[model samples]
Target: MTAEIDRRSILQVIGIGGGIAFLAGCGAGRTEPAQTEGTSAGISFRDQQGRTITFERPVTSVVTIPMPAASLLVAVDGGADHLAAMHNASWVAMRDGILGTMFPQALELPHEIATQDFTPNVESVRALNPDVVIQWSDAQLVAPLENAGLKVIGLVNNGKQEDVDAWIAMFSAMLGKPERATEIKDHSDRELAEVKELAAGRSGPGPSILYFNRFVGGLKAAAAKTYNDFYIKLIGGSNPATGEDPLPGTGMVGLDVEQVLSWDPEVILLGNFDGAMPQDVYDDPVWKNVAAVRSRRVYKVPLGGYRWDPPGQESPLMWHWLGDIAFPQEQSGLRGKTTDYYRMLYNYRPTNADLDRILWTEQNRQSADYQQFNAG
Candidate 1:
């Protein structure tokens, strides 16, 4: 661990707001000094906010701020080894290794910084002196790092297409790993292509779904186009509040009783929080009148993987879950086949346990049956 000066230079770095330092790659085989007065020597690319961010070469001493952003990095290069630090300190040390075990190249990188939000560690970040920092949609966080004389870039991994693509591309541009980025993006695109082809001609009665989970308050629905919506769309399901605009960053879609009654979807799906499902909805006279309850079409989505939480970028678990719902024939050890699919698509092999752990976890299993509403 390199200890840096806590003097004015450190203070000067964080004093300015929104002024991020950037790098330019100097090409392979040429050793150049790390820092120049203004910019680095390498390639430049446009970031999601349409700002021009340049890199001096594949960034080695790197820090990842958000949990979702880390996947894009890992997708681009063998990101695990290059990571000098991360902001998702809660589970990165424990679960990331297990997840990284799925990829042969993504080795364990020791963290230089701790804390889930990265807010408490300016002095610590300065001490580690990472070459670049990657954050997914926290500009407020960026301002402080920019002030600290660090190169900070933004990534979007909150389950939106635009964000996912931009973040992946940014990683490609910064790491000199365009090929890897393209490979992953292409694989994602291809998966959707198959999904589209499957749904192109057929229009089935949309499965009514709900995503109620334990929040700080009571239960809440996952908003549209959020990771929830992404998987729902992939599996050809319908959210009861389908037409409402999705909230940014949070992806929450607010719903009330009238909205649920108006949609009257046939199926209801709930997130398994604390191993408890809202079965009382069937007993409630008002909810029993709803179509889903009357028709006895309700299901529970399994909750597993870092329990007591929703599934997002951290778990590839959702894909298997979606596949189970979308294409049953593909479900018999499909993730094992995913290893081959990745090899065919990405030229990388995924281990069996990686596929298994990602698939059959408690997070993937809900209650054995939907407690039919049976109102009428």
Candidate 2:
């Protein structure tokens, strides 16, 4: 078993240091904040510290301080269009498929700004004159941005229900898109309801699910309540680490080897994101003794839109992905049939070529390690 990753390492993995360090620039406020016309559509939220904050209109001239926040904003609207700069340049590169042909402007962002680290050239962000800047819960740093007279929104990507709902609702309300907020809330409610309905009276101890991610020499399973764990539950699967500490947004906890062997999950859904397949693990002697491996119930989670990123209201696609992987009999061409799901959930359909292009890009995921995650 490998040792679990520490908080510092996790930050590094997300690209907060070294070559992706912050760039120097002036901190003077460049743009004035504007209030939206109406109040009916606005939503008020209390932050983790319990201060009331109001969102009156959609944020314009957005700056993506972190990668996950960038993905979330993009899902809500053309955040990339508002993005004056970013911390991760890799996300914009053509090879990554995150910026894509549609958002060519994203590629033009200043080179000094990359990744989510605050180390980027401050001058670039100041020059863009953004109305809002999105960052994580780092209060100390976020305070300075607020002091600079920038409206800062903190996003939680840990995947907890409370955190997720608040993030979505607040953003939607602030963006003056109550319809979009309602859309996300409705979809989330439906998915949770369906999960409860399907799991009702299913009998026996529930199937165990774990998220295997690279750590020391092997892999570590995320705790329950992490986004990975939440997604499993959203699809009617169970994670044995229900009693573990909660990770916001993601709803995940750390799992040690001993704990994994103790739970000995019957059904394993290996993320295997970086070209690591379930078969690869099952073929190895180490995993052969696991119940899931022996039963041949271990499966690979797809790396497309549904897998790596927060499906957001886009969770309807999660159902399709789950059905294809866990219940192939129900696949019914849903994976390839983009129209119905796209329309029902997102209320729009990409051209067949759009669908084809998206799927095709996924085929060559290994060409770049960040490609799958950056695809949102």
Candidate 3:
């Protein structure tokens, strides 16, 4: 069942912002420590913006402004010990979800720094006295933090698999744990290889998927070049909205009810952001005619240490789960793989109840535990 298609080649062909080639290995060489005033050790790497950044010493104390970045920090560092502060969103997920279940100590860490919306409070961050600040690669955001005399590193996780690998490598180097980075990358590569094999077994075109983000004024769908869109492609699912142009900068497009009906996707995946659930879609009159709803093929994307739909350390596990959802007959061992992943990475074997919560299964949807977990 091994895929004849080279995974890296396929990724480049479908890469966002045109085909950016996947690097063969970690780029940006390291250099000897120079006599810089503040830096104890010298390390350099290329960031997502293709800018080279050098650190004086290993980033021991960190403030991750973005929720996803917090997850990455904890994962690559092998624990939450180095995290001085993190976005509130990651803290919430950690408290009520599998993160807390695995690493209860993370609950004790200070996560009061308010930067979940990408707006950093300099006073609040300065109080934490972090050695480095990790956030999304936005110049405007980086400038003010620099002005405040804080060392900041920018990262972009736009759903490209190669980029995720690069991030693991870059963060590992920054944390002075190149061995850990290699371990993480090797695990991810192995998992992706498994997914490719499963995808190769499928006969016809994969299921037509629509990743519904929210139901605000209209249906906001993940468009081409978006993270969710890239995930769909990675898992061998076809996005019905691919032909439509993405919204400027954001990579999400708004689709009216009629347009969604016209696309009539075979499978619908609800994003974990908004509180919208499968019941809402099933109950809506306009949505009733959609093929996915009519066939009972709509599913809620799982949320664990982080949202499975986003770019994070849990992406390998995400690929396994999505592969099962996309081709259950061929990739039916998601639970076993999930068990191995949690045990290996988080050092906690999830209970049956935890699996239900993480998977967002129908049984979980009917239970009070799920309600309480979401309410928190």
157: Cα error in model 2, Å: 5.0
Instruction: Find the 10 residues in a row with the least total lDDT in model 3.
Output: 7-16
TM-score of every candidate: 0.65, 0.65, 0.81
Candidate 2, lDDT over the whole model: 0.49
Considering TM-score, where higher is better, how would the candidates rank from best to worst?
3, 2, 1
> Where is the poorest 10-residue window by lDDT in model 2?
6-15
Candidate 2 versus truth, CA RMSD in Å, comes to: 11.3
lDDT of each: 0.49, 0.49, 0.68
Candidate 3: tens digits of C-alpha lDDT, residues 73-135: 777787888888887877877775688767777787777776546777878898888888877
RMSD of each: 11.3, 11.3, 8.5
Which model scores highest in TM-score? 3
Q: After superposition, how far is residue 328 of candidate 2 from its true place, in Å?
A: 5.2
Q: Which residue segments of model 2 deviate by more than 4 Å?
A: 1-58, 87-124, 215-218, 243-259, 272-275, 305-311, 323-338, 341-376
lDDT of 1 by residue, 1-376 (tens): 0001111110001101222233222212232343322234455654433356665555776777665445445545653566666655423423533444444343345454545445536677777788787754356666777788987775434444434555555566566655655665666666566655654545663365655543224445665445566566656666654445333234554456665677675656565432334355665687777776786544445322222123322223344455445444434344444565545433466554444343333332332231111111
